[model samples]
Every structure is written in C-alpha cells, then in structure tokens.
Target: MIGNGTAVEINARKGIFFEVFLVFLKLGLTSFGGPVAHLGYFRSEIVEKRKWLSESNYADIVALCQFLPGPASSQVGIAIGMSRGEWRGALAAWTAFTLPSARALYLFAQAMAAASGGSSGGWLHGLKVAAVAVVALAILGMARTLTPDRIRASVAAMAMVAAFVLPSAWGQIGGIVLGALFGMTFLKGDMPSAAAALPLAISRRVGAVLLFTFFALLLGLPLIAAMLKSRDLALFDTFYRVGALVFGGGHVVLPLLKAEVVPHFVSENDFLTGYGAAEAVPGPLFTFAAYIGSAVGGWKAAVVCTVAIFLSSFLIVLSALPFWNDLRNHPSARAALNGANAAVVGLLLAAFYDPVWSAGITNRTDFALRIAASLLLFCWKTPPWLVVMLCGVAGQVFM
Candidate 1:
C-alpha cells in the first residue's frame, strides 16, 4: 500500500542504518584517545573522508552535544546517525560504537571478579599519556579550522581561561554559554545562511513524548524505588541520573559515578582499578559502568547498569534532534553555534592541560615520550592504534 516515494525512503533509511553501524563498529574497535580524540577521529572519518556533513555542520553538532549532559563524542555520533537515517540510525550508531568497549569492559569486570586484583600497570599510564598527545593534536587541528578569526580566537582563549580557573562541569557549561552570547554580539556580522536541514524520522510529537518520558523517569524513579525499597531500582536510578545530569562527559563522569557507587556497592580499590582499565580501552569511558556493575553483582547486573546509564542519554538525544533540526536553521542559532564551536575548541584545550597533560606528563622523561608520540601522530601521520600500542610498550619498558 505504500507509495514509491515512501518505499524508497524506507529502503534508504535501512541502507543508511546498516552503513552507519558498520562505520561506527570499525571506529569502536580502533578509535582510541578518549572522548576528545574520538571527536578528532569522527572529524577525519565522517566529516573529512565520508563527507557525511560539512565541517561547519560537524562543528555545530559537536557544540550542541558539548552543551548537553552526556558523552559528547558519542552524542555527536548519534546526531550524525540521526542526520543520516533518523532515530533508527541513532540507535545503530550508539550500538555499533558502544558495543566493543562495553563488551570489553564487561568481560574485564568478570575476569577481575574472578581474580584477586585488577590491572594497574605502567602500560595503563602509557595509554593515558598517549591520550594526552592525541588530545593535544586534536586541539591544534580544531583551533586552526574552527577559530580562524581573531574574534573567535579570543572567545576560545577566554573559554580556556574560564575552564582552567573553574576546573569543573559548571565551568565548561559557563564557557559554552558565554561563547554563544559573545557570538551573538561580536561574531554576528555577515553570517552566512544556515545549511539545509537534515531529515529526521521522528516527529516533534514523538520527540516530545520521549522527552517527557526522560523527565518522568528522572523524577519518578527515585520515589518509586524508595517506596518499594528495591536496591536494584535504586542502583538503576542513580546511574540513570548520572547520565542525565553530568556535563563534560568521559572523565567528568568519574567523580559522579564514584560518589554513587564506591564503598556502598563496590570497594574503592575495585572502582579505581576499573577506572584505570577504562583508560586502556578504545571507546566511551562510560563503559566503566559495566565493570563497576560486574564487581557489584556479576554479568546480569553489568548489563542492567550499562543500559541504565546509557538509556537516559539516548532518550535525550532522540527527543532533541527533531527540534534541533529546525532551530539550527535560524540565523541567530547559527551565530550562537559559531561561538559555541569556538568554545568547544577551548574546552578541549583546557581538558588537555588539566586531566590529559597534568595527569599523564609527570616527569621530564614522560614529557619527552609524549612529545615523541605527538610527532608520530601529527607529523609522521601514524595510525592511532599503532601509536597507542607503541607508547604502551614504551611505558612498560621505560617507565
């Protein structure tokens, strides 16, 4: 009964979904260097190579995801998938991208549960150091392309200073908001018209329903769990809230997860061990939830917790995409996005200095090693996975 146009759209959507799944599955296996570096990889693969979206559109997506309270890079991927094939594409992207790391961490958690201790080796430190180099290169590349004008450059610099001074989630949020405001005032002149809007499968009505569900669970889950006194429900509620509320994802989720899980459900040692192991993996740091869950209640609990943590985030994105598709076409929205994009560069730069650089670069020898890794990545154009392997081996041998 479907018209030819409708049937063609359906077929195209299915094709796009499969394509997105394969691409992200490949990335999930190989994309290293944490969330910031994942953004870089996405830029290279989706924006530069595949030409799925323009550089400006990609940056706009990054800025929007950064503004949201979830895994920024993963959320960006979801948005990319949504643009390509709507809600189904978003789910495919998330699944393909998240599955490899989630499975690895889950298996690791099971192994650690069987063993006495978890992995805490010099090689792990090397992976963290490699993350530093990767983020540094990303900052350099994004700054060059995103902050071309002095006005935008100033916005980035100011955002960096704000993030450095505050050094928290709120600071990052403030920086992005300030950038949008600054862009509206200073960067607004002669702005180009917005790009053509992408098609989304979900309607505004459906998006609204999903959004309402997101808030309903956020507010109602705790009350219901309290009434029932169910520990399982409580656990899901806690992680779901964490996914819903935290900004500056990846490492930023650490403190929140620690506060919620440690000493109450799992030991501090186990939690820290899992966190360290998460660094060596190649996908979103949120997968640490699986490890923590396994330590607490085995594989079933691991699946439960991982799904709980990621679900709210997916819901929020699905809810927002339909609306964002329209809002992004407005001139003021485009201007604000320009400022937000510059701020994203600054945010990554600050992240590089604090957690990435400060944590990884401890000594002159570490400094030299990181510099070498940076050269391999930026100048020599080495593969990231290879660089990660080499640096990890070097860390095991030297450090």
Candidate 2:
C-alpha cells in the first residue's frame, strides 16, 4: 500500500525520536550473536511486537540493505527510524544501536595498549585463533550461499587469485570489480518481479544527491588524504572505503581491513584480537573499527573511524531507499550483487591463508586448536562468543 515513486506521509511526532533511540539502545545492549541474529531480534522487536511495519515491508527493507555494503542490521534500523521519525530518528537509531559495541571495543583496545606484553599474550593469540576459526567458518557458509554454481565458483576462485597476486586493498577492490563485470556478462537472468514499495521519506532528488556525495567522498577522500599527507584523513578514508565496498556484511570486511590496517595502523595481533573481542560484543561487527582506531590514535581516532565507517551505511541506505523500488527489479543489479558476493568468499579465503591461518597456526598445538575451534563452530553450531571464550581458555592453557 506504500507503493509510490514519491515521499510517504511523515509520521513524525513528539518523543518518537527518543522512543526509537531507547528501543535500539536496548537492542544494542542485548542483541548479541552477529548481524544475522541481530536481524532476527529486530524483526521480533520492531515488526512482530511493536508493529512498526508489515512483514512484507520489513522484508523489502532487509532485502535492499542486504544487497548494499555496510552492516545490514544497522542499515535496517536506520531505515525503520527514518520511516518512523524522519532523519532524527535515523540518527537516534544508529547512535543507540552502535554505541554499546563501539564503547566496549574501545575500552578493550585501551586495555590491550596498557598491557605490557598484551600483543604476545595467549589471550590475544586465542583471539587471533578465534578470528581464524570465524573467518574459516564465514568462507564456508558464504561459499555455499554465494558460490553455488560453477560460474560463481570460478568467480570466487579468480578473486582469490587476484587477492593473492595484488596483495593489497586494490586487489580486493579489483576482485569486486571483476566480479561485477563477470556477473553482467555471464550471470544474466530474467528480471525480478516487483515487491511492496517502502514507505520512504526521502525523495529521489535527495537520494540522488546523497548517492553522488557518497561516491564523491569515496573517490576524493583518498586523494585529499594523499595530497595533504594527513594521517587522520587517511584513517577516515580507509574505514569509510571498507564500509562502502564490503558486499557481504559482517566477516567480509576482514581481509579488506587487514590489508589496509595491518602493520600500518595496527599490528596483526591487535587486529585479530579486536575482531575476536568483537565476537563477544552485543552489536554490529563494524564496531571493530573503533578498537583498531583506538590502537592507532586513541579515542579521538576511534571516534573518527567509527563515524566515517557508519556514515557510509547511512548514506547508502538513504540513497537506495528511493531507488530500490526500481533497482531491485533489475536482473543485472541482482546478477552483479551475486558476482560481488562470490568475490567476497574468495577474499575471505585469501585472508584465511595469510593472516588468519598463517599467523594463528604457528605449531602443531595451534593447528589442533584451529580444528577444535572449527568443530565447535560448524558441527556443534556453538555461538561465536562462546567459541571465542573456549578458544581463549584453550590458547591460554595449551598455547
């Protein structure tokens, strides 16, 4: 019933913004188990209980955000906030949902920095090993979902090769580009049937402007950072770019982040250590940026990185809201997304080999720990936070 090519009636009301903030903050504090679980929690809280939107409407929002880069759960929260209380609602939702995890990780980073031998500590190594298991599990699950056919499998394989050959952020970006090209050429399919239109408050013009701004910053930030040689600007650019380019949410950002930050902004141990600790937190995995930024330049850097990364998500979800009604029906868009997702699997695989597998498995004990962690993750279907704890204990005692 919300179908249209124009703005929906504003539902803005007094206290609605604060209401949205409170709801999301509650979710932030309790919604653990990664992005997928976060989605389920949202659907229950917003759609089922609160009755914010119909089932089909929520599905459409999720569908749109899932295809775009950045954390899908956070984007969905923003979209709902916008639909309910306009832009202020969107801001409230994002702030509340992200604050818990970001604050937790920032504190963790400070502690690690304060610890004298923290980098070489068994707990940190266990975190690294946890990252190994997590990434390995991510690739397997994603490959099954994203690389189902021979063509997509080949795309993933080629992406892995590209990541290895180039061995940098460019390589990862190239693989995504390559996947889009291959998808357009070979993965073409019939156009999708249209779905219920979202109750978007943004106009196509505003969405277009935001979309352009998103790309402009994406393209211009790096040049500006390089020209001015400003490390802070460069830091913002790196996190923003990673948030913009990641196809699959959550674990897909691992390799791209590792490529950019490892040895430059943060060491490999601190990187994985943060990632593993992120698993234990109760919000978006993108908050991992806060920890890395803290390690690089303290809380101010943490604030910059966190803002820069999530800002992309806000821009993208807002931009796409007005366009999704048409874009989601295009067969080519879907195909390109498929190819990009396949490339993500390949990227994860490459990450597994280098920083994940290579660094985590230094000896027979570590190798055995990897297998046990994998089993706990895959066969046991254990929660990742639990896995992190178990692995940390094992790494402390055995490793």
Candidate 3:
C-alpha cells in the first residue's frame, strides 16, 4: 500500500486486489525471460525493491511453486499476490502473469501460418536454447539456496538422476510426496522461519475440505466432459492429461505432446514448428494447447482446449502447492526433498539431451552456435530476448 514518495492509498480490501491485478498485469507484459528469468524479475521487483516479502519468504514461496505441476513462475506470482492480498489477489496475480504471454502466443501462431518454416526457424531455435539455459540457471541458483549441505545435495543429485532415468514426473512427485512424508513421520516440530510462516487464518478442517473440493473438481471436470462425449474431448483429454501427468515444467511437456498430437492429425513438422513458435511467445507452455486446438478443432476447440488446459494446470498447482510449503518447513520432509531436487536436475539434463540438445543441436554449425549462445547467456550476459532474436536471424541465414 505504501511506497517511496508516492503514497497511493486505498481501503486495504480493495487496495490489495487492485495491486495484485496491476502488478501482475505489468509482470505479464514485461516478463520476458523464461521461468528463471521471470523469477529474477519477481525477486528484484517484488522482493528486493518492493519489499513485499523478504528474500527468504519469497524464495520459500518459489520453492513451493516449483514443486507444483503448472507454470512455476506464474504460480509464484499468484502465491505472492495471494499472500499480500488474498484469493482476489491470487486471481489478479494469475491473470497478470498469464495474459501477456498468452496473447503473444496467439499472435505467433497466426504469424506461423503466413511465414515459411525456413524463415522463422532460427529465432525459435535460439529461444529454445535460451530457455534451456534459463532453466538450468534457475535450477543451479535454486540449488545454491536450497541445498547447503551434503545431505541436501545428495537428495538433489538423486532426484536429478531419477528424473533422467525414470519418468520426469517421478522426480517431481517424489519430491513432494517424500518431502511431505518425511515431514509428517520423521521431521520434528521445528517452526518455519518467521517470514515463511504466516499465521494460519483458516481452520485446519476448513482448509482440508477446501483443498479436497478444489482437487475433486479438478479431476472430475474432464471426466464429466468425457462421459458426455463432448466434441472437445480430445483437446480436453490431451490438455488434462498433460496437466495431470507431466512434471518439471512446461518445457517437459513437449515429448508427451509430440506423442499425442503428432500421430492424430497434427504433422510432426507442423507440431515442432508450432512448438518452437510457442517457445518464442510468452506465457505457459500449456497455451500451446490453444494453437493445437485452433488447428485441429477450430476456434471453439481452441477455446475449449485453452480452458481445459489452463483449468487443469491451475487445479494441479493449487492442489500441490500447500503440501510443498509444508515440506520445506519440516526437517524430515526436507530430507526427501533433497533427493527429489536432485532428480529434477537429472530430468532437466535428460531434457537437454532429448529435445533441446539432441533435437536442436544437430549439425556442427548448430552445435557451434549453441556454444556461442550459451557463452553469451552465461558469460557476457546478453539478454535472452536479444539472443533469441539473433539466433532466429542466424537460423534463417544458415539452417
């Protein structure tokens, strides 16, 4: 409510809601870098500069969101908004965080229809590369904070490997489940840090009922649609399954999407092109469902698909986030989280190899370009958006 010099005062009830909507609107518009970069922006703007939450508290919220199933950065934004304002704030946060990228993606999908594959491919490649680096940096940065000791480090390492070797979702689920179990069964009653522990306002019973109701609706909505044999079922099914199943983040859903959409009617080449285009646009990867729906099912399908996917994503995020909060606060849960974190690393590594590295880094020039781009991102600190732009030009000229 209070900022330096300019004091914009409103009733606390309305003020928080407006602030959430406005802040998220700005974030949605300007938030350019992938998830990690988005995190950086949030930390700098909201945490450090705005003093909305302490760095530790902000990070705790982020950790909780990361372990959830939807877009991590967006969820973090929502959590911040909610923490500051309440459910209305949470609504504002999600809308602001998601709307910009979603709109941009809609434009990108339209552009792809007119442009040739060769012309737009490079920038898309660059964006993917940049995305990969951003995710890696995020994992590393998060690890530095989350894993301070050998035990935690070991947990992270194990999680990473498990992600690579088994399914990626395994690591994510493992982290949350293990973190919770460890906390409940083993970790003793150690209070959460002051910033991280807001006093529980809702009754425990009420909270449990609400959480259960939210998830029940989440699971039931799509099933209900399916039973009715809705025309939008495929789109809903795909989006719901993607929302329900995939772990790590939006990028990880590419493979699953490929498996489902490609064989049905969407061309492999077209799918990849759309995917690359999706990477270039802003918002959650799940929004790609919009493009897919538009292509296969028309505008109505696109609408249905977008709603289904977003709802599925929103529900999963809601269901999983509180549990993640509990895990981080509890000691024993922290132990299992250690392993799960490592598994996330491993899964990311695998993603780098399969889709990002293997698929993108094909030729010698492509390989060389990747190295140069990585250097630019990691060393010289060129902006990722610029890197993506340059890479696109490079892709047009060369690849």
Candidate 4:
C-alpha cells in the first residue's frame, strides 16, 4: 500500500486492512441517504478520492451485487475490500461499514422499547408516518428506474396486485419468480457489451463449495430448526431466507420482514416504528435488521440476526464472483433480471399500500402529513433523514 498525498493505492499483499477499515468506518458513520447515497459516498471516498479502484471496477461490482440478493452497497464495500486484502480485507470492510449503523439501530430499538413500556405513543405514530412517505418515495423512484418500459411496468403492476391478493411472504417470492419468467418470455432485447471481467482470488472449486454451503444452509436450516423446535434457529432461518430472496434492495425487504416478524416476534407498531426510525439512520438501510433483532431477543439476537442477514452476501458474492462474467453475458439471464427488478417495484408498491399506508395513515391528519412529507421528498428533493425527522415531530404535534 502506498499513498500519494491525493490518494491511497492498495494491493493484494500489503498491510492495508486497517486503512480500508478506517475509510469504511468513517463512511458507516456518515453515509446516510440509503443505498444509492451510500454508493455515491463509496465512489467519492474510495474511488475518486482514495483511488482504490477505477470507476468501471466499481460499476461492475455494483452491477453484480445489485443482481445478487442482500444489500448492494454493503456488498460493494465487501467486494472492494476483497480486491484490496482478500478475505481479511472483505471482513474488515464489512465490519467497519456495517457495524456503526447496526449498533445505532440496536440501541435505538432498545431505547424505544424501554421508553414505550406497554403503551404506544405519539412518537411511534410519527415514525410510522415517516415510513409512509419514505416508502412512497422509494416506490416512485424505483419504478421510474426499474420499470421504465411498458412491459416491465406491467410486470410491476401485476406483481403488486398478486401480492395484495396473497398478502404474505410466499406472495412476494411468487411475484419475483413469475416476473422472471415473464421477462424471459417477453422482455429479452438488445444488450450492452459486458464490462471487463473482475480478477478474483477465489478459485472455481472453492466457489462451488461455498455455493453448495449457501444452498445447503438455505434449504436445511428450516428443517433443522423445525425438527429441533428451536426459536433461535427459526429466527436465524427467517432472516437468512429473507436476505437470500430479497431482490430490489432494502426498501423491498420491508414487506418480507413484515410478513415474517409482525404479530409474531415483533408487534405491528414496533415494526412500523422501526421502519420509520431506520429511515433516519446512516449507512445501509439493511441495518434495520439490527433493530428487529434487538427488539425480539436483545443483543444476542441482534448479533445473530445481523450475521444471518448479511452472511449470504459473503457466501453468494464470493461464490458467484468466479462465474459472474459468464452469467452476465447471457441475454436470458439479463432478461430475467429485468423482470425480477420490475417485480421488486411491485413488491414495494404492495408493501407501501398495506402495512405502510394502511397502518400509518389512520386519520385525515395523518393523511395530510404524509402528503406533505411526500411532496418534500418529491418536489423539494429534501434529504430523506431530515424528512423522516420532520414527520416524526409533526406526528407528535398534530396527531
């Protein structure tokens, strides 16, 4: 590793583990505005300023992570860390970049739980309202980007309708699968040439083994947990499955989580409050998992849930790294991704309407506040965290 006053250059063998850790640690503390904003921070600090990787390299990693399940920004950080210091770098990068928000959310959940006692408060309602605006904004922006063409838009709409009909986790998964099939059947079209292939340290053989482990855990954990009747294992399985299946990003993960946790492990009010509170935090929105974990079973659950949620990103990213180029070049695979992306929008739409809109907007006052927050998000282009904070305060004052 060497630094030219302007930038830091890291290679495979140098002692850059700590440097990489610190850079991402700073980002974890300061990188707000959700995943897209997180990506911008990574590009500015790691790419343009630090010179750790090229623009194309970052873009390629972003593309691959977006295709895979889990948090794309965190995975991008892990991938860049891998390039710098192999597994050690990846571990360091993920820890530093993820830990800050995770810890903050865990503490916040604990604080809210302690303060609220047995009764819900106006602030909780405020947070729920914040979720209303944030998710609405997310759906609109994602639809514009992911479901741009008519076919994909239709896929999104149908997926939303199906989710409404089923109203469960199975519905969300089914929607994604159907969208993929639809895209493969109808959306295949022109393709851009593939980006330069990433140079990976993991061999094809190791990738295969890790890939097998990923599937084995995915398929077997549920059975193992069921046979043993262990709630801990069951919790882990729920989060792991969610991490593996979620397609669009963090916002889409909300509905899947609602299906899994609400009315069982966590209450409806707690869930929405956490969802709204998550919008106010920095780093990847996925740290919202930490809040859920803490709510159910304290710090232990917090650690376990956090690991379960993110473990797939490590296994799948490394496992798929060796084979990504071949897959990326195939038109069929790309078309399926297009369909899945559209379905992701639908899933968000479904989630927004039910748990988000329905729970948050109970009265005329709540509805008016949500509209104002949405306008702040859309027309004024206010930062999300600020909008969320203002909503919380408004919920306290007005309703």
Candidate 5:
C-alpha cells in the first residue's frame, strides 16, 4: 500500500523513478563486500532511509529471493522497483543496480591484469583470502537462518556432506536430488506464508522467459558448437554454467565456480584472488568472472566475460522465480527447500577444506588468522568492505 497499482500510499512521480534509479545506481557504484553487504545496504537505504517496503515485507521478500537462485539483492531491487512503478520500473531497477558494478569490474579487471604485469599476483592473493573468509561466513549465516526444523536440518547436513565430498558437479546435483527426496519423504509442513503473497503480474512472466532464453542461447549454443569444432570456451562457459547450476544464493555459486574455472587455467591462488576482488565490489560476486576473463584474454575478454556472467545470472534469476514460488507454495516442496538449505552447510564445509581451509589454513599461524578473520566478520561485525581492503593491503605488504 505504498506506491503503485492497488498498492496505495505514494503518487507515481516521474521524479521518484529517476530518484530510485540514481539511488540504486549509487549503491551499485559504492556497494562492495558481496551479497551480505548488498543486503545490509538495501536494508539501510530502502527499508530504513527510503521507507520503500515495510520491515516485514522486506524480510519476506529477502527470504523469498534467497530461496530462488541468482542474486537475491538484485531480485529484491527489481521487486522494490515493481512495487513502486511497474514493468519499466523493474527494468530500470536492474539496469541501475547492475550496470555500474559491471562497468567497474570490467575496468578493474583491466587494471589488475595490467598492474600484475601479466600474471595475477600482488593484491590477488589477499583478495582470495578475503573471498574465502567472506563466503564461509555467509554459508554459516544462511544455514542458521534458513533451516530450523529437525528433519530439514538433517537433510541440510547430508547436503553439506555430499557437497564437501562428491566431485563438484556430482555433489551439487546430488544435493538437489537429496533435497527433493527429503521433501517428498519426510519434513511435512505448511507453505511459507510469503510464497502465496507475491504481487507479480502475469504479463511480467513473458519478460522473465525472454531473459531466460537469451542466456540459454548464449550458453547452449557454445557447447553444441564445441562438439562440431574446438569452439573456444571462455569465461562464458564457466559463468553461464555457474549461474545455471547454483540454486541457493551467492555463496552457493563459490564452490561450483572454483571447480569450473580453476581446472581450466592458472592456479587456485589466481582463482581466489579474483573472487576477493569480486567480494570487494558491488552487485553480484559472479562478476568475478570478469577478472578471470581478462586474466585469460584481454579487455575484449573482460567485456565479453562481464556481459556473459551478468546475462547468465540475470536470466537464471528470472527463470527460477516461478518454480521457487511454486516450491515454497507446497508442504512437500517446502520440506525439500529446508533440506536443500541444510545441504548448503555441507557445501561450505567442503569448500573450506579444499579451497579455503586447504589453501589458507597452511600452518597454525595461518589457521589462527583465518579464525580471527571469521570472528571479525561474524562476532565483531566488521564490515566486509573495510575487512577486504585491509586484507588486500596486508597481503600486498606481508602475506
């Protein structure tokens, strides 16, 4: 009851739409520290400052988007826009939210590659450490919040173990299957209250489909061509695949990405470094692909890679909403979501071992640092932006 059709408190001023655009654009420009920061920023600006959505509505939307794939903040931004104006407002919301950060990443990738003198070293190391720490914290926070019931927690525990032990693709697929089975078998419950309450219109479903199809073409055609000839698979393949497979949230994308891109070229060091830089930026962490792309190719590669990742992520986010909405609508599917949510813990656990813990936790001193870092994020509530910057500088200076 605050802005547009049926919703009633404010007038739909042209000025307000422009203001919304500028506001999120600024957030996109200044927002760094990954999804947690993005959500925090959204709460501070939209809910607290702008008073766009009531706190209950905001929490409901956040929970809904978390269950859906792609970027939760991005979806929340689109939903906020729709609540205010309409379809064009949604478009404007995504554009302003995404473009500035995408541009920043492209340029940043170019700069990093140039600064590193061809190989990614220097700041990249610190960035990787920061990324691993941040993601680990995220998985922990999400698990605590999402999985409450005993049956759901058990499912999540299994998912976490499977994600940790199974090969990345196999483990993720296995987790999803396990979640579905758990939902179908046990964990009976009512549908989440928020699922049936969404305000989207039927017409906008077409927009979602179009966006989904665009990325499908971008991803599917390349693989098909790879069969005919040695089609050059670049950043597109990894990011596109990462976008498609990642079901839970931004943190879920990390391990899948680690598997996809790390094996192709460079070392784990370079991979994590890019991830850190992505964390330090705004929008979505998937834009980490730009750094990888640029490192692999050049500015052209960075541009293409940035577009590919963004489009891939955008489409997946759009396509999954309906299914997610439907899934949350049922007791059985809701149970499954709960189970799947738990598995995220296992996935993070696995990631900690192989990539984060394995790489960063070398000696007792390093292990202590990591623990300190986690506490800084979780207990001290240190902002990730400041943490990442300090870490990058520290890695440059000492580690």
Candidate 6:
C-alpha cells in the first residue's frame, strides 16, 4: 500500500503533466505568429492566467533561452513546464507544443510524396520566394532588436563575415564563441544584480548530468555512428548537431540544415520546398525537420530526424534550466549573452544572403515577387501563413 505522502506526490505529478499538456497543445494549435508572438501568447496564458511563474522569472528564462542555442520560444515553454513539474513536465510541454505542427508537416510531406512531380509547380516557386522574404524580414527584425549599439553592431558584422566565408557548422559555433568572448571584454555594461536570481526547480547535480549528457552526445554520436557504419545513425548525428548548435531563432537553422541535407540526403529544390511549406504552417519552424526527413526517406526517417533534432534541443534546455538563474544574474554571463545575441543576428544575415537569397531569388521576376512579399510581411504586418498562401497563388499566376 502506498503511503499518504507518496500517493499525494504521484497524483500531483499527474496533474502537473496533464496541465502542461493541455496548455501547450492549445498554444501549438492556436499560436499563429512567430517566436516573438508565441512568447506573448505564453506570457498571457502561463504568467497572467495560470500564474506558473512571475514576470521577472519569465523574463529571466527568456533571456537564458535567447542566449543559448536552439529554438527560443520552445525552450522557454519547456523551462516553464520544468518549473512546474521537473523533467516530466518539460517533456510534456515539448510534446504538446510540437506535436500539432510536426504532424501537419509530416502529413504534408506524405502528400508531397504522392504528388512528386507536382511539387515543382509555380506555386511551389512562389513559396520559395516567400521564404526568401520571410528570412529577410527575420534578419532585419532581429538586427534591429539585437544589435542596437555600435559595439554589438560590429560584433554582428564580424560574425556575418565569418559565416559567409566559412559557411559551415564550425563557422556558426566559432561565431558564437567569439561573440561571448567579445561580450565579456567589450559588451559589459549595467548588469542585473545576482540577488534577483530565480530559484531552480532541479538540483545542480541533475543539471550537471543533463549538461554532461548533452556534451557526450555532441562529441560521441558521430564516432559511434562511424564505428557502427550506419547511415541512419550518421543522419541522426548530423541533424542532432545542427539542432544543438543553431543560435538565433528557427530561421537561423535554414543554412545549417541546408548544408547538412542538400546534395547528400535530399535535393536542393526539395529542401527549399519543405522550408516554404513550413512557413505556411503554424507553431515552431523546427518542425521542418519532419518534412525533410519524410522527403529523404519516408515516415520512418521523418520520425527519426524529427526526434533527433528536437531531442538535442530538449537536452540543452533541460541542462540549462537548472543553472540559468545563477548564470543570468552574473555580470560576465550577461555580457557574453549580449555579444552572443548580436552574433546570432549576424549569422542570420549571412544565411539570408546565401541559401535564402541565392536559391530563391533567381530572376528579376522572383526578385519582384520577393519584394512584394516583404512589403506584405513587414509593412502590412500580414500573417506569415496567409502571406505564404497569397505568394503561392501569385507564383502560380505570375511565375
């Protein structure tokens, strides 16, 4: 027979899990705007209504997620869930938030597979053009917010040059590291007091284990796959590393994913097509992994790649959450994050020029279409999916 305390704990855990699932599932289905907007929705629901965390605490978590790699909004959501119910709550939040978008993209991939030849139509081209516009707008928006100061602006410029020159996973990682170092040396300013640190839900020991596991996978996965000589394992390793290392928002993953997938697992056209389709869907852009995986192999690959990408993100968030409060309150950490954020903006700008612009903006007509799409997205403040649909129709008619 269970003791009273044990029974109460079990019941409370179940309640927390279910609450996290329901709340995020709703957001996953309904959250239409990008990461910034998703944060607004999360604040409204979780902070205002549910009262899971205080405003300052939520802001601190957002700061930590922004400073680290992977999807920021998703990480924030996972952190909130963990705050409510530890690792289980974090898993619940991620699954509920990601499932709707992942399922939609996976099913769409199946449809695209069925209509293989049909995917190269004018509408698809329009989608590609729209993607170019979307990424451009993202870069502009992020730059405005992240690199306001001249010092930060310079860091962004340097990072952009490095990424443009190298155009590899290592390039991105190096850019972030350099940004942090620069931040520590040059970007230090009025730092937040350490007294404001939020309490950790998980202990330092657990955080250490999670952080250790993250590095172990990062370093060991490729070697393990090579030893086993498994193509599937290698694919998983590639996607996992990409997911683990990407800074900025979901769009930042574009160049990284393109480098990893195109000419190897999938064609360039197919990769761009999936990216376009991702814009038309709601929820996190990371779900684009599902589409890429499905296009390359089938549902099996889809499942594997999707899990691989998101699992890395999950591990990173879990590892960081337990120690984020202390990190954020430190002056050095704040300075490093300032530089890192600006560097991320630079990385996005480079991506916009390369795979996004070069691949999508082919002719004068494509350029004109992208310009119009940009106006719609930025000037008109149109919804992305709607903009995607209009662009698709415009592509069919014009391009």
What C-alpha lDDT values do all the predictions have? Answer: 0.77, 0.88, 0.61, 0.86, 0.67, 0.84
Error of model 4, residue 284, in angstroms: 1.1
lDDT of 2 by residue, 193-307 (tens): 4489788778999999999999999999999999999888999999999999887778888989989998898877778788889988898999999999899889999999999
Candidate 1 ranges with C-alpha deviation above 4 Å: 1-93, 109-119, 189-199, 214-305
TM-score of 5: 0.80
Q: Model 3's lDDT to the true fold?
A: 0.61
Report the C-alpha lDDT of model 4 over 36-140, residue by residue, as the tens digit. Answer: 898999999988998888788888888889888888888899999998888888999999998998999999888987885413777678778888888888888
The alpha-carbon lDDT assigned to residue 101 of candidate 5 equals 62
If scored against the real structure, what TM-score would every candidate get? 0.68, 0.94, 0.73, 0.94, 0.80, 0.93
* Residue 201 in model 5: lDDT: 53
Quick one: ranking by lDDT, best first?
2, 4, 6, 1, 5, 3
Error of 1 at 78 (Å): 4.6
What pairs collide in candidate 6?
none
In model 5, what lDDT does residue 399 have? 57
C-alpha-based local distance difference test score of model 6: 0.84
Per-residue CA lDDT of model 6 for 142-181, tens digit only, reads 8888899999999999998888788777778888888889
Of candidate 1, the 10-residue stretch with the lowest lDDT total is 189-198
Model with the higher lDDT, candidate 1 or 4 = 4
Scanning candidate 3 in windows of ten residues, the lowest lDDT window is: 181-190
lDDT tens readout by residue for model 3, 332-380: 5544444444444444555555555555666787767777777877799
Off by over 4 Å in 4: 1-14
lDDT of 1 by residue, 242-281 (tens): 7886656776665456556756788655665566567667
Off by over 4 Å in 5: 1-17, 47-60, 83-87, 116-123, 147-150, 194-199, 204-219, 228-234, 316-327
> For candidate 5, lDDT tens digit of each residue in 1-399?
334653432445566678778888988887776676788998899889988777877776677677655667777787777666665666677778887766666676677666754345544556656766787778767767766667767777787788767766678768867876777677664547643454555345765776669566755856765775531354556565666556665667777777776767546776766666666666766666667767777766766666655555455544554455565666776666666666666676677667876675556545545566677898898877667776777666765
Candidate 5, residue 180: CA error in Å? 2.7
Model 2: weakest 10-residue lDDT segment is 3-12
Q: Judge candidate 6 at residue 219 and give its lDDT.
A: 96
Stretches of candidate 2 off by over 4 Å are 1-14, 190-194
